[model samples]
Each structure stands twice: as C-alpha cells, then as structure tokens.
Target: MAAGAPRIFVSHLSGVAVFDPAGDQVGRVRDLVVMLRMGQRPPRLLGLVVELATRRRIFLPMTRVTAIQSGQVITTGVLNVRRFEQRPTERLVFGELLDRRVTLTETGEEVTVLDLSVHQLPARREWEIDRVFVRKGRKGSAFRRAKGEALTVEWTAVTGFSLEEQGQGAESLLATFEQLRPADLANVLHHLSPKRRAEVAAALDDDRLADVLEELPEDDQIEILGKLKQERAADVLEAMDPDDAADLLGELPTDEQERLLSLMQPGDAADMRRLMSYEDRTAGGLMTTEPIVLRPDATVADALARVRNPDLSPALAAQVYVCRPPDETPTGKYLGTVHFQRLLREPPPTLVSSIVDSDLQPLDPDADLPAIAGFFATYDMVAAPVVDEAGSLLGAVTVDDVLDHMLPEDWRETEFHLDEEEVATDGS
Candidate 1:
C-alpha cells in the first residue's frame, strides 16, 4: 500500500489471493506478521504469511508488497520462497489476536476483538495496527458471541496485547530498535553478548538478516551465519548480494564453502564461483553481479522503474547498464551506461541508448583496488561497469565496496556507545 491508502480491516484480508507484478497468481494470504510494541503503542505491520500453490507458506515482507487492493495482494514479483517462520517478537493477527478479550480505555468494559485495522502511515512505508473492532459482550468465541455494542476504537483504547516492561526478551528488544538502519543494527549486534546477538540474529527475517549481515564485521558475519541452521544459512546466503555472499563463502574452509554453494541456486552458485575465482581485491571480487541491466531499446521510464526497486542499494540504483541482447550480466554486447541524472532529464519515452555515456572507459575484471580507486577518482563515479575481453558486461563495482576493501580493517569496528541522554532522546 502507498501513502494515503485506506485502512484495511484484517477480517477482509484472510484468504485473499496474492498476485505478482505480472498478474500471475503466486499465493493466498494466510496470516499477517506484526511486531507488538511495549504499552499500547500499536504494533508495526511486518508483512504477511502467504501460502503458495505448492502448499508451501512463505513470509512476504511488506517492502515487497506493492498493492493491497480489491481483496488482492500484489507483490513486486521478487519473492523468497522459503517457508515462513514466526519470529520470537512476531504475532499472528488471525491465529492469536482475534477473539481475544481486552478492556476499553474509555468505558472500562471488556470487549472481544473481532478484528483489527492496519494502515500505512502517510509519507512512509511503515504500516501499523491503527484501530480495533470489538464487541462489548460476553467472553465466548468472537464469531459466536451475541452481537452487542460493536464499534471501532483507536488502537490505544485497548490493552492486553502489548509487551510489558519487565522480563523482556529478544522480541521486545527487536521492537524497540525496529527503526534502526542495518549498519546501526549491526553495530548494536557487535556490542551485544554472543548469546544475545545470536538470539537477535535468529529473530530477524531472512531479508533483514541478509542486510544486517552485509553491514556487520567479517567475524560477526561468520559467527551469525554459523549459528543459523544449514538450510536457513543457505537461504540467507542466497538472499545476500552475490559479491558479499562470495566474499563470505570464500572465508570458509573449502569443504564448508562447497557445501553452502551447492545448496544455493545454480545461477547464484555460478556467480559465487566466478567471484571466488578472482583475487579478493580485484574488480570481479568487489563488483555485484546484479546491477540493473536493460536492453538498448528500453525507455527512460523503464530505467527509472527499475531504479525504484526497494531491494537495490543506493549505489546500485545510481545508474543502469544498457547492453545489447541478453540483458543479464555476461550480456550480449557491452553497451554504454545511462546515468540516473540523464534519465531524469530525458523525456520518459526517450530510448536509453541515445543518452548512453560511452566516454568513460569500463573497468577490467582483474583491475586492482588502487587502479579501480583511480578510475573512480578520475571519473567522479559512484559505480563503474566491468567488461570481459569478449566485451560482455560482467558486473559493476560500487564506491562503498571499493572503500570496504581500501579502508583499514578496524574501520567498521568502532565502539558504538549510546549515552543515557542519547538513548532517552531516541529511545534506543
């Protein structure tokens, strides 16, 4: 749902059909995953549990959900088919919340929860439980309860569902720090006790855990990856950026690396193998295999739409590569690039090929860190493409990855301390 969308009552979403961007049916909504906060602060809507055609259930993060309209859930078409596993801090709206008994703040009368309404906050993507539909009647099952005074009340008007202050565990901790950036969260993990860090890591969803793992120190990344079950570890690895996954896998013993690589999708495994074959400090090792790739005939509008994908990092989204046939990396012919700024200036219908900047020479896959750094400095580029001798567009290296290799080993290991005042101010 977008900003200013209507509040959707949970009762309507149950068993709703879910479709992909292409309008192909992917699954049906089974349940919603929410993170309940301390007090009656309104639980954040995490995502939904979608049951696929294969009778397998998957966790579809709200970030991937593009629309919830006409009793159908439309996704961005980028889905992780892994089974949904409820986290320690997560609550199932249908299974656990409905039919529950609670008191109204205004009348002090007990009411049974018939349903809950959720809405995306205006100007933000975060969705939260907003209101409660309850009945002021007896304590029987909500469906069978004799209809009495039924009304919708503000989420704060009800009590009993929110987490309490005392004896809080990982769930509460996750809810409290929910708004932290991946880097900030990784820093938090770095400072936590091993047990606590493992608990927190386990509680995070695959996509989220993959992101946090990317930002963490190498040792911390390995430790967290090691703690997860082998199957889940493979899933997390597949979810990660190809270069980062390769880097992590390269750190393991040959046997361990092969085991994880074997479990990953063939294409992903191939990318990892290709990356691992390169010297760690070279362009091939540093570049991400999955930059936005489009054909010469693609329009500026098409490029812009690709850039808008939430999954792409800012660096990766800065520009798009226009190639010949075979749009994927190792594409047909390495055509020039079209910077995002160029796309914005051109009319929507303008072909990307016309605005392609061929002036900047591409990087060789074997280009060393210093050489790649020189190219970035000379061209003032945030990212640059790498092409093979066959003129195939291999991948692109972003400045952040360049810095990761160039900077001192301890650069990301800063001791992040939140003073009492800072903690109170931001509720850290």
Candidate 2:
C-alpha cells in the first residue's frame, strides 16, 4: 500500500495532528483529496481548521507529507495559515463540512463522532476544508513540491475504519448520492445518455435532483425530462414551480407532451395544462403557482400565522395578496398585497387594507415575458401578480423565477478560464 521514491508512506494516521519538520503544531488531517480521474497516484493531503483560536486549517500537498508515524503526523514545512473567513471562494469547503462528522485520530483508532459540536466548524457544508494543495502560484499544475513536511501515514494503516463508523454529519458520497457542484452536475447530466440520465435521476433523492434541475438550461431540462420515466418525470416536475414546469413542458413535441402529461398526478396535470393554455411568452405562462394569498378581513395576526405555514415559498415574501371570500372566488379577487416586513417592523392588529399596497403594479395575462421582466426592473419588485381582464388573480411571478431564463448556463464555468490553454496544458 506504499508508493515509490520521493513519496513516503506511513500507517494508521487519518486525522493525525500534523506537525512541521521543526515539530510545530500545524493542523489536523482533513481528507485525502485525490483526482480519481488521475488513476493510482498518491492522494493529496488536505488539513482541516478554521483559524488559530478559531481552529485554523490548511492544505498540504501529497509532496508535503514527509512521514506517517504510528500515532503522529509529520510534515516537511510549516503551512501558511489562512482564515476561512477571508476566503469566500473557499466557503464552498466549509459548507460541505458543515454537519459532517469525521473520525478523529484517537489512540491510533477511528470512532464514529456523533457531532462536530466544535465552534470553529460552521453549520453548513461550505465550511468543510476539503482542499487540494498545489505548489504556491501553480494552481492546477499536475506536479508540484509538497509543503514543509513531505510524507504522512494513511489513517487506515494504524487502525481499521468500521462501516458502522459514521462521520459526525457528513454523509458518505457512495452511501447516499454524489454531492457535486451545480455546474459539475450539469456537465455530467448533459453528457449522459437517455437511459443513464434517468438512472442517475432516479438514484438521487428528490431534494438533490430538485436543486440540480433548478440550475440547468431549458434545453437540458427537455433532454433530462425525455430520458426520465413518466412517474419519475412527473415527480420532478411536480417539485418545480408551475412557471418552470410550464416552460420545460412547452419545449417538448406535442406527442411527448401529451404522454408526459398523462403520467402526471391529476392535480399537477391540471395545473400544467392551465399554465400551458396561455401563450408561451405571456405573464400567465410565467406566473408561478407559488403565491401568498390571504383573506382581506384576516387580521395581521392571522396573516402572520399564514406566513408561518411551512409550505409558503420565499420564506420572506414582500407582499401578501388579499383575496375575496372563499365562496365567491376561491382563487381570490385581486385586492392588494401587504408588505410583510413593514408589518413586522411595526406590529399592528390593523385591517390588512390599512397596510396593503392598493396601487399594485399588475400584469395582464397575455403580457410577454420580456415586458414582465421589464415590470420587475421598473418597479424594483421581487414579484408581480398576474390577472385576467376581469381582475381575477391568477398567480404571481418572482424575479428569481424569471431571471432563470435570462442567465446563461456556462456563465460560472468561465471564471476558471479552463479552455484550450489549461486542458491542453493539463493533458501534457
């Protein structure tokens, strides 16, 4: 289980407290971050910590690991301690580690840690320090010198890890589903065949797939939906907002659309059909089924109570629409929307009408999306209510929901600037 010269292998040393050649306490073992696509190369060393008092952590390259001891980890040089706070881009690691429990290097053995109850570790996954260290100023380079200490032992050498051994909060990638960045997930999904795409989607839990689907483009969405089984596709579409669901379905051919609709739950199928009835570019098509509706006579207390409903979207909605009595127009006649934040800042039992924005900017059912998007910009509104000629409230559309169409899928990947230059460079 050892590699050749220029690399030293040690035993039973995962999460071992790493020290410099001078034996200065540096940090603890984070994880073995390896490029699996790179084959059987020695994995890189990633040390974990946030700050000195905050429990600072740093990454040491595979080259920096000098030797692994029976119970101690030794490195070739001191690590440059960087506070996690100073690295926004690095926040991704912390969020990944949040709620993830790791086995501590204790007495040359590993044990399940119920909780990471440590103060320095943030409660989100982005806080986890799963990093790969390259020689300073040589990011993405295949070969680089190790930091201070050149060798360290594998934690598995000293003691065996139990399948029952749980990480405090982090779920194993294999046991659950792969937790990939949105862009990375999109890349994989884009390249997968129809059968494999459905397999991948089915394997993942609904929550994870919902998030990944939200980040994909309309074309990709159509491809993925086509691959998915009717039942599974219906489930995924049901989880999406009506506007998103409508847009995605509109991309499909007539036969495929009817088939997919046939597979959906009765209520969801009805909702989608209703949304699809309108012109593709209209406000009706863009309106999301997600809206905050309240009866006009309901007190501020009642409105706040409705807001507390777990099912409410936008945990913080700018306005709550006042509806007519359930018997008259259950969909509710468009009265006005009250700003929830205003009520919270100034508690009041006053009638909703007293605080409601009666002069609300509204969208006609047939208004084009670009026109609707413009309404968002002009009014600086997070969402605008859509109505028919009779002023009957249909649904509301939020800025984030509409902007999903405007933003480009590849916008994020451009930051790495990985093109013919880097790929060619790395391939060599």
Top TM-score model: 1
Could you tell me the TM-score of candidate 1? 0.90
Which stretches of model 2 miss by more than 4 angstroms? 1-188, 191-199, 305-316, 327-330, 407-428
TM-score to true structure, per model: 0.90, 0.53
Q: Which candidate tops lDDT?
A: 1
Angstrom error of the Cα, residue 15, model 1: value is 1.9
Model 2 weakest lDDT span, ten residues long: 112-121
